[model samples]
Target: MEPNRTRLIGEYIVGPRIGSGSFAVVWRARHRQLGIEVAVKEIDKKLLSPKVSDNLLKEISILSTISHPNIIRFFEAIETREKIYLVLEYCDGGDLAAYIHKHGKVSEAVARHFMRQLGISIFTFWLFIFDQISSAGLQVLQEKHLIHRDLKPQNLLVSTNEVTPVLKIGDFGFARSLTPQDLADTLCGSPLYMAPEIIQNHKYDAKADLWSVGAILFQLVTGKPPFDGSNQLQLFQNILTSTELRFPPGAIEELHPDCVDLCRCLLRQNPVERITFKEFFNHRFLGELR
Candidate 1:
């Protein structure tokens, strides 16, 4: 069968704009020769500052090197004087946020499926970094571990699948690579999903990402975030002062005990008290899904 062709941007046939952000626009495109569909993120260089430009380069580097089915695949990059094009694996089902908004809360089985994929993707980041440090003979100071500082429903893309929709983590603009023991002080991520440590302006490590995961999981089953307020200040205040994670009264009655336990463990205000990645991956709730 002949390939459907469209307006050519470099070697790709650019189709429709699928997404856009402050300085970039993502388009659905196809390789001219291969005819494979891909998402092309076109970034305007003129809109980027020196620091933001450096972060873009780092994002490119991370995407280029990482390989995981649950993480968005980066094919190649094409750069011109004014714009930079990132060719990526195309996800047809949009993002988790939109899916949740359309479908409302999901069943426990479905939520389990999504959480398992997310957990594995997050674990892969740590495994990839540790491998780089040990196998590449890179010095601890030079070798960096990645933290997807911005992990939320919006950042998770869904690819259509026959049996089950596949989830892939995307948007690494706020991601940072630090030494194994390093802690980040930068305040980043959506206020609702941000860890309390970050809200309090305390140095935090990868445990912060786990808190975001809990927030995502909580929303997946409850149809609303674990905490909420009228503004950012109120939101942060709620996150900081609230001692317990609560599910909606009606939602609580429908949730499994293990699922509730997992959320509570992940949402601990103290990073030290929060469940570790190993524990989270092995939690009974996720274990039962396997």
Candidate 2:
């Protein structure tokens, strides 16, 4: 029996199914009284493993506490014995992955615009966590950073606006509140956008997210990911062995030097050499936007 199909979850009437994944289905819904539209992600509890269940709770915990313009807004959660319905703000423009596929890359100006939003979203999360740790006098606990392990275009949703579409970071399934110093060793995230340390089974931290950002920025201006292979093995090999981050021949001439420089800095194979979030937020490519 599909729980939300042609039925109500609390006061919200679930309408058509809007999206889905292996364990969950997202429905377009509206409030009975206010008639306000929202997205309800219905997850089947029975389908979850212990690890996945823990991640779901972690995601809920993180979303419930954080509020930022660039992050997805969580409205409420309605849970039953069989399912969990997450009511969230509706974004009509869809995710950045679909946008990139449809538009087939964008101008450097457009890339900068999108990157600025992404930078702010990630940086704001850092500040938010920092403030909490400081307020609690837990500065010595270096494991308080919230790392969005999987930072890719697909997880970034665009909220349509009359002047400019707003990009909001979503999908906190792989996010963890641990700093780089903690050196989390979990192997997770998409192959193309994943940092090298993660792929090699090396301990990594929040800097891995910055590498994903660089990959996204690269794909944004070049129309394709920086590295590609027929299979995961080959892909990982290419990412590990590639000494230089090269731009498509004609692509470099069209972009600002700062843009290319930022990509190079962020994609450095060695995490120690990669630019930190502070530097990324202050990078010249995004400086003017700030």
Candidate topping TM-score: 2
Tens digit of lDDT per residue, candidate 1, span 157-177?
989832358888888788878
Model 2 C-alpha lDDT per residue in residues 17-80, reported as the tens digit of each score: 8789889999989999999999999999999999999999988887887666777889999999
lDDT scores for all predictions?
A: 0.82, 0.82
**10 residues in a row with least lDDT, candidate 1:** 133-142
lDDT of 1 at 222: 92
Candidate 2: residue pairs that collide: none
lDDT at residue 76 of model 1 (Cα atoms) = 89
Look at candidate 1 and tell me the lDDT of residue 51: 79
**Stretches of candidate 1 exceeding 4 Å from the true structure:** 1-6, 121-144, 161-163, 288-290
Model 1 residue 241 CA deviation (Å) reads 0.9
